[model samples]
Target: NSFGSCSRGCTTIDKLHWWGASIGNAGCEELSTQLVSASKPYDGKPARMVKNLLLGGNMVGDACMGALARAAAKGALKDVGALGLSRNSIGDAGVKALAEALAADVLHPGDLYISGNRFGSTGALALASALSESAAMRRLERLSLADNRIGDEGAVTLADCFATGGARQLESLHLHNNNIGDEGVVAIAQVLSRTAMASMTTTADTKKSEKGIFRTTFETIGTLERLFLCTEGAAEKPQEDLPPAELLPPLYCLRTLNVGSNRASTRAKGALAGMAAQRSVECSV
Candidate 1:
């Protein structure tokens, strides 16, 4: 349909909190369709001050939801701080599209919560890479990617992306209930170490410009405060048969490591103990 029709539908539900259960699915689909159409003629102007976009229960089929979400995010909605798409509502393709759209802009950074959706390694990596590449998303202080089927490969890709300069503004990262094991954790740790070093070096270079140094220091502190690594309910459980504790020393920088509800055996505990002994890695099982 035309932008006018889509705009009207968006406006209808713009202020209304509840759009009724019966029409929720249809409404979302209509909105998605309209958004896709509108994005083509987008003028790069701010559209709205959308603080939150919640598409949890709306069973909108996955065709171009990503593009549509991106289109809605253009100008007016650029300042959107929160985007929630959880549960089994949207398919992998839809989720991927949404992430791709969100990553396109460096201005729409905030909290992104996507959980309970059965995304495979490819989808997980796509979403993670998108977020990592978005300068705006890097400014975010929190990101949650829980309950997805992201394996070690996906985790490695995400860790690499975050390590890139694109994610310099990150403060927190949550990847719980995925299959990211010791290798994934190691990748994340390496990134954190690199970022910390880079931040320190940047601060040291500010001796020449006092004014710039002050601003940089403030921004750097803000970024670090938000950097949290929380991995609760991950796939691998700590085993009873402990490996040499020497392997655990590398993950000391992690703020909150959650491995609850997993089948951590004795071996797992030993490995964790070894890590704790080498470096202070707080963990919950």
Candidate 2:
């Protein structure tokens, strides 16, 4: 199972694009060894040439994941940007290993796509904790946990993580098609409300900076997110499966709110107007 033979043809000594090299049959031992070996070309300099590591559609089991995590601990894949582990059989154990790597600032991927792997609430919680504990996680922008077995509990944990630190720079998040309920939506709304203020303040600071003000206090977005409270692709048939508008708060602030879905649009619109009535500032709902 040594990918040694394919390693030569698969990797171009300088760059490697073996998207599905070993795939399902490739275990952790070979890959970890491969990664560690990849970091050996330079005697004193860094041998991190692989920027994107796409090892999806395989069953890189938990034991192998531990090995991969160890390899990462040694700065084997330090320069990896994207790590794709979709369609694999990675469960909570495997996810925990990866999370540990992230928590320790060992594996730093700009984008992590772990969709379709059979990881559930535990895995989600582990990942949330990892992201929360690591400041290095701010480099990560996109995260996808769709089609997993994550329920309200995991969703809430993720929301709390978002509300806290380590997720300020996160932009796009995919958590649809899971067992998330109204509680989860409320948690998401809460995150949006909490995160919006700091985001807006950061933008204000950026404007001040542009105006030649020497004030360095708060961190801001490279691409600041504007507050937009509106729903998209409105549902017409009154989908009962969706969360209730009543569960949301009066203000229901958002960075990008989209609540025009279902038969309750008029009621929500009125509610939004009522909430905005007392406010002196001008902010669209």
Which candidate ranks first by TM-score, i.e. highest?
Answer: 2
TM-score on alpha carbons, each prediction: 0.61, 0.67
What is the lDDT of every predicted structure here? 0.49, 0.58
Alpha-carbon error at 89 in model 1, in Å?
3.5
Q: Per-residue alpha-carbon lDDT of model 1 for 161-213, expressed as tens digits? A: 75554343333456667766666656655655544443342121123243342
Model 2: pairs clashing at backbone N, Cα or C within 3 Å: 230-257, 230-258, 231-258, 231-259
Question: Could you tally the backbone clashes for each prediction?
Answer: 24, 4
Off by over 4 Å in 2: 1-22, 42-48, 197-215, 219-285
Predicted structure with the largest lDDT when compared to the true one: 2
- List runs of model 1 lying over 4 Å from the truth: 1-25, 33-48, 73-76, 192-203, 207-285
Q: After superposition, how far is residue 95 of candidate 2 from its true place, in Å?
A: 0.6
